[model samples]
Target: MNINFNSEDAGQIVIGAFALSVPIAFSEESWHLAQTLPLGNMALVVLLSLGFIALFAYQSVFQANVMRRIGVFWLRVAIAYLLTLAVVSVVLIALDKWPMLHQPILALKRTLLIAMPASMGAIIVDSFDKE
Candidate 1:
């Protein structure tokens, strides 16, 4: 498939991220998980999220045609993940869950945990309507 990253794609990603993030952001388990989970586990979450994004990007959008549009492929993955991270960060900040000033690591852990599912949502939405 010929995938073009466009404004509508961004909007879809935002909507998808928000759809999954709000529920997870409100979870007490998520809050505590972030506070207690080790840094290594969080690193695994990051890798897992990226892996899923890359897999989907290759299967649904790039379709083994990535070499020709490497920039667009990377852009889609980056935008989906980063946009979801931004959305997750805003939600956590509004909920007072992100204490960046005092406990930056915990805050980052929370964001990464939440971004996993949220970024998955974003990628799924990005793949919509492409046959």
Candidate 2:
């Protein structure tokens, strides 16, 4: 039920998130979706993304005693999601794709859209060295 956030795991998650998020973040369709999707719809996407991340983590990172490791499991899931968000945000900013500061909601939606796939990759990568 206990898990540690080691540097190697963190590095893997960062690499995985970056590898997946960058291309999606650059997609014009993704950007347009962020701008046009209704707030409720975007919120749903965010929720769905987190749900998938948790499922993936359970299946891969915490296959045994998942319920008993609720706190650690959620912590790992949150870390993966947060890392994906950061990677997506940085990539968007680097590519000049980030929404204006006044449009924080749009930025959040964009990041969430990209974070969906990024978090999947991260969760999978996390499973690579299970012991």
Candidate 3:
């Protein structure tokens, strides 16, 4: 399958990301967990998020033809993850939960925790328009 990622894909990713991010971003439990979870766990979460995205994209979007279109595969994954991260960060910043200046680590943890689900939403949405 040949994947042509364009502005439409980006828009879908952002919408999908925002769709799931809002609820998780507002959750008090997530806020508390972000503060309490150790940095190592946060790192694990990041890895898990990327792993799931790659797996899903390969199976559902790329259809396991990664060798044929390695660049497109990585590009889709990168866009989905990065766009979701941006959406989550914006939501957190708007809610005053992202204290980047005061505690950058905490802010990043919170963003990562939320981005996990948001990125899934993005990948799923991106797959919807595929042939």
Which residue pairs clash in candidate 3? none
- Clashes per candidate, residues 3 or more apart or on different chains: 0, 0, 0
Instruction: Summarize candidate 1's per-residue lDDT along 1-131 as a digit string, tens digits.
Output: 54887898889899889999999999999999999999999999999999999899888877767887889888889889999999999999999999999999989999999999999888898788666
lDDT of 3 by residue, 24-108 (tens): 9999999999999998999999999999999999998888878978888988899899999999999999999999999998999
- In model 2, state the lDDT of residue 34: 83
Q: Is candidate 1 or candidate 3 better by lDDT?
A: 3
TM-score for each of the candidates: 0.93, 0.91, 0.95
> Candidate 3's C-alpha lDDT?
0.92
Predict model 1's lDDT versus the native: 0.91
Question: Per-residue lDDT of 21-59 in model 2, one digit per residue for the tens?
Answer: 888987999999888989888778879889988887787
Off by over 4 Å in 3: none
Give the candidates in order of TM-score, highest first: 3, 1, 2
How much does candidate 1 score in TM-score?
0.93
Candidate 1 weakest ten by summed lDDT: 1-10
Best by TM-score: 3
lDDT of each: 0.91, 0.84, 0.92
lDDT (Cα, 0-100) at 113 in candidate 2:
81
